[model samples]
Target: MARFTTSTLSKYLLQAQVAAQALHTETAPVPPEVHVPLRKQLKDEAKKQKAAGKKKKKNANNQVVDGWELTVGIEIHAQLNTAKKLFSAATTSFNDDPNTRVAFFDLAIPGSQPIFQKETLIPALRAALALNCQVQTVSRFDRKHYFHWDQPSGYQITQYYEPFARDGSITLQARDGIAAEDGDGVMIGIKQVQVEQDTAKTLAQPGGVHWLDFNRVGAPLIEIITLPEIHHPATAAALVRKVQILLSAVDSCVSGMEAGGLRADVNVSVRRGDDPSAPLGQRTEIKNLSSFKAVEDAIIAERDRQIAVLETGGVIEGETRGWSIGSTETRRLRGKEGEVDYRYMPDPDLAPLVIGDDLVSHLRESMGQLPDVEVDVLIKEFELTPKDALSLTALDGGMRVEYFWNVADALAARLGLDRIENLACFQLAANWILHELGRLTSERSEAASEELGFTEDGQCERLPVEQLADILFYLHTRKITAKIAKELLWVVFRGTIPEKYPSVLGAIEEENLWFDELSETEYAELADEAVEGQEDVVRQFVDYKQYPQGKLMFLVGRMIRLGPEERIDPKNAERVMRAALPEKYVPALKASD
Candidate 1:
């Protein structure tokens, strides 16, 4: 049998088309009888599938049943956030018209040579250092030859033999969406990280015609390979998310799975038994999973598929497959390609990439703080709850984290205290930013996009940091009650720029929303006035003793209504009301108090 690779398949299709066209010129027309049976067979199969869809179907058990063990390793190709193509000076763009961003070198025009872009190395180095990988002093590129419409050059330039970095690791914390069975945390090893060129996108139209978009060709990419250390499907998903977070934190890659900034290729295999020495089953590679959920579901579906094949005394083919979200199954794409099929060779155009230790040190110093480190600082130094820390850091690619820090620091400055000395301010800032403003922003972001505006990354600009700090400052200083402060927050959230009024304090003063700074004597007078009118409520409290606390609260509400303009603090009103209560109605106080 002829071995059919991608290159061979394209040639075969072309040759067969030529032969068919020539034969059609010389041969007589076929009879209708030749086509009727095939049409009938397809229609019958469609009817059967349609009928089966109407019945309630049990979800296939994806659990690795009894004695099976599964392992998964992920390969991620993340497009670096750079302005130009890896080898050409053609600008990179996601929304540009197709074929417009291509350079002569990108299109493999005659005599066009590859020129390495030194700017690409800074981000690549930051990523390697963030992942704890050892940077190699020298790395070289290789040409992996294959034929597909996506590759105009007919080969991909990659770092296969000497990747720039290796032996990194990332820990999957239990709190970071890993399953409990995976233990507190699992440290997964990074096999290597390499720089590569991306191929053009292939969009398949009807009738087997594939359109090539070269806007993506020769764009810089970093391929992160991991050892097959994952045992469960959820863990694999968590690992991918960890990589996304780390890459985004360092400003190396946006890692936006939906926008094609990041794509994962998962290799999954299963075997029977718990022995470490057991021979592994033939593994199938699932290509181009675009979402975290797809990463998990594809692994489970592939694992179950392999187990089924093995249990039926059948062989699992080592092939490439595509994931079907609709059926939740893996569909075969092609048999796997091995090293010989790729025909890897050193690129004749580019020389070895050499880096000095000083450059690596500079990148390491210039790297932004990672998310985990920021999470720890939020929890320890800032005294935020662990839950709030994670939520704050995870929002909008850590833009919220920056907003929170600014608010917290400004509050401390206004209060004339160190942040550590005023834990209440940090806690208050976290509560409002994470819960109140966080929710308000999320709910109104779409409707108020123009009013709220957005950062360069498209995150809704959080309520300005100074305005939030002013509100917190007033509440801290007892100038405004929490209730009035919340009202102030809502006012500022709905496009009310408190800074225009000079500050939140200025807004409060200008709007007459400040809490009444009344004395205890004034509160007692109001409480007395409250009891004089509501005789029935007072009777229930003093004589009938029916729901005494509720009746007393009713009196407090009455007193508050009388002074609505005062913005009366509810706690002070309730306290003064209890004190002004008729002695007969006074509940016995605890001796301990």
Candidate 2:
């Protein structure tokens, strides 16, 4: 240390005194001469800044967690149901013996060359149109280099630099239970859709030996990539389901997650701020998620984990993870691969794919109504509840939708009605088809389903649509009770209609399967007989504060059962019971009603 001169020491002391005075001035009360408006303005500005800093954010679960935001994106690889493999003449079969379907090109033989299949492009174009993607007239393939037993060629052919389609989006509607708070649908953008080849299946043996199945090698795939704009796990899952519906509607792919026809790779990240323009957080991808529930649960689990790590002052590592179904968590697989690691290069064997404008137009004209469009039509034209419409359309690739339409058309034509006097009947038909028919069909095995004259996808060929419509029409006209209608439905479903009757109405008339309009005196006698043995239940219903209100229906049904030979009107029995009771108990009876 060097000694300081007296002048230098005085200079340092003066600087310290000035800093202390400024600090005191900031902390202490202001003088009376300070303008009140200026002081108020400064306080207001400070409050605004604090409020902006601590703004609330929502997690992937749509729960409020201040200062935390979630981001999610998905990549889907769907196997095309084409006749042949992408670059070979081998037939595509899911159930073929392990390596029997492999072509020489699939094995990377010494002199074999890849011959691109023209059949695969039709489905790819269909998918592009279904997703609202812009198809590229000229697109080429590139080789993605990697070292794995799954790819014997040491590289897989894909579209890296130039993809088949781009700039598409799938809308998740609010009625479909996505973004319900917004009251409108949210649109998830598609980055690109590429045609690529899939890797082989790897089977691990007991002693760590691996078995390779080349049946899936060089199979055609259309990889769809979406932008990192989804903020909720539910939204991400909805996007996946919507893609499945659209692909199936266009007849492009089977879109079966359980059958391994479609695979999803979910990329999830979490950031501290809500500003979308801010740099995205480091993402970890959960690869090869095989189910919709796994897609949702994995995103939620990974997002929470990243948030937890960041809260503890730990940095997130970029890696690939696999979802553990048993533990309900994500386990690390390996470090994430970047573009440089893939070593992508253009494939010199195949020329650029050229699509004509005429083909696109022809395909567009040939396409039928898509699933999303049909969903809206069901809600608007037929007045179906959103839940019921979704349930009907989502089953077996819209097979239920077709069945429902057949019944609806039969009813409308027979009744000579449009939306008039048939809205409730339409809804009743929907309930019968979706609930009763669905449950009945779901209990059958594949063999049993076929025995009932149903296709593999549950399309009915033997069920009489007109007879089912007659049952609903009779119920709507109050000619038959709901119980009788259900019984007739069972008879119709099993093809057990009586031999003498030519039609459903004829059977109902011949068998007298209808209710008798009971007189008031007869209803009174039935109510009195019903109450003779069930006095305790009647008293409890009267004192409903102590007993459940469902006892009233039990008493009513008991009265109806007293006249079991003929179907007596239940409402008449209920009315007689209420009138026979004390007038003071009438209000309690109304409460039960």
TM-score per candidate, in order?
0.76, 0.80
Q: Write the per-residue lDDT of candidate 2 for residues 309-339, one digit (tens) a residue.
A: 9999998999999984423468999885552
Candidate number of the best TM-score: 2
- Candidate RMSDs in order: 10.2, 21.7
Instruction: Please give the range of 10 consecutive residues that has the lowest summed lDDT in model 2.
Output: 26-35
lDDT of each: 0.77, 0.76
Q: Write the per-residue lDDT of candidate 1 for residues 383-463, one digit (tens) a residue.
A: 777678878876666777777778877888898899999887788888987777645545345433333433434244546
- Decoy 2 TM-score against native: 0.80
Candidate 2 accuracy as lDDT:
0.76
Q: What is the lDDT of residue 131 in candidate 2?
A: 90
Question: In candidate 1, which residue ranges exceed 4 Å CA deviation?
Answer: 1-65, 204-210, 324-327, 337-340, 440-462, 476-478, 481-495, 498-500, 517-593
